[model samples]
Target: MKHPKDPSAPGTMRVLDKQPTLQRRSFLRGGGLGAIGITVIPVASLAASKDVAARQSFRHLGAATGRTLVRMARDIYPHDKLADTFYVEAVAPYDAASAKDKGVKKLLADGVKDLDQRARQRCGVPYAEVKTEDERVALLKDIEATPFFKKVQGDLVTGLYNNKKLWPLFGYEGSAWEKGGYVNRGFDDIDWL
Candidate 1:
């Protein structure tokens, strides 16, 4: 007796294939592994838009790199009042740039890998998992002279600070020039100035 041949190959798509995309929320929820992560991953600036625990992804950067960038952005800005979501948003532009340019992709990818490597050398864990603030800051300072660090600094200045939703954290009252300048607004309210 002989076995019959299969109609379609395993894992290949057929006209009526029932496979659902892993990107869908149903996949994560269906899995009973509890939380599928190492540390609490940062959500994108769209913090107000979705379930943050589901995780934020990047087209150019890996999950670990995204997490590292979140830490780097926070270290640079040092905004204890703000959440990691804002730092995630600030670092998101690097991923977008990498998606657009292969050179940028290589630069950022290599830069982040190096940064992570430095962290591992200092401690035993990756950059995002490093416990001490001074250690992380010192690690960043090592790369402060590189183009990658400069690009991150320049982009983050706008990406982190220019966010209207985050302005209140920095005490910026949303561009006083648009409201006829600050001299007549906040300053005027300070009577004894």
Candidate 2:
């Protein structure tokens, strides 16, 4: 009478079987670590979990819009050596500003929509989903003069590149105060006049 899924089980583990409920007291008595509950779920469920996490992560922008912003930011900065994570970090303040200001939110939404529409006209795809970098660059160029683009560029100029976490990536040693100021550090490293 072993279970089909679990050979050691004494019965069949049917799909319709009711999952056991755990009581707090019983859970505590069971040495929780030893009686850890495990459940098998469909891949779709895992995807949904990721979707939920993504939704929570971006407060102001939707996934598609956020993606478009990331691309635009990368284009403006053109830091091919840096990872996408830096771009995401750079755009976080924009997202926060959008969350706090309705006008900013509308501007971002409209900007994203405008970019997508441009992409559609050029390549029949959304801006965020555009496959070719050339097309993306073309689309961005079309909107480069817009206030939306300028705002994004201005915000990212300082926000993205100024991050302390990213300083070391570009050979920046950060503040000189930590190691007893620039006098002791390599402030005078310039030897070749």
Candidate 3:
């Protein structure tokens, strides 16, 4: 029962021997789940802990900071037809940047605090908790010229609309290269004239 690679063990199984083989897709999927605060448990324990994944919470940024980023992304790219998930995805780069750069992290933290302070001064509440849209808009107007706002806005412009998952929803067929360069796949379908 000893692993051939190990010389010390005679009858005991190695740690790798007890683990199941992992596929690349499954591994990436697990990582994605982890990023969103979902725990990937063994399939054997899945039935018993179906609710565990639902209860787990993961936040790349602080809860308040994340909320503010989401709201800001939505404002910058206002699409009433799009779901909140789109806005969340749009702000993911900011979260990632904050994680990698100390300056970015400080910028986000300070920006969120400043926004909350402005909201408190104007509406007696935190920015994320502000009830009136007009008040939130006014608060955003005050900070729109700041470097943090401009950075997030610049990131949102490309990150929000350039996502491949959103292309189909917006009637974008996404690069006809795979279909023979769209030579016969509606490339010349336009006949409005």
C-alpha displacement of 89 in model 3, angstroms? 1.8
Q: Best to worst by TM-score, what's the order?
A: 1, 2, 3
**Tens-digit lDDT track of model 2 for 1-193:** 5446874576654465577775432232212321223323445544544323234357667777877888776666655445566677778676788888989999999998998888888899887678876677777767778889878877876777588876665667888897799986987887875
Runs in model 2 deviating more than 4 A are 1-56, 177-184, 190-193
Judging by TM-score against the true structure, name the best candidate: 1
lDDT of each: 0.68, 0.68, 0.64
Instruction: Let me know the TM-score candidate 1 reaches against the reference structure.
Output: 0.68
How far does residue 62 in candidate 3 sit from its true spot (Å)?
Answer: 0.8
In model 1, the clashing pairs are none
lDDT for model 3 comes to 0.64
Better of 2 and 3 by TM-score: 2
Task: Please list the residue runs of candidate 1 whose C-alpha ends up more than 4 Å from where it truly belongs after superposition.
Answer: 1-54, 191-193
Q: How accurate locally is residue 168 in candidate 1, as Cα lDDT from 0 to 100? A: 61
Per-candidate TM-score against the hidden true structure: 0.68, 0.64, 0.61
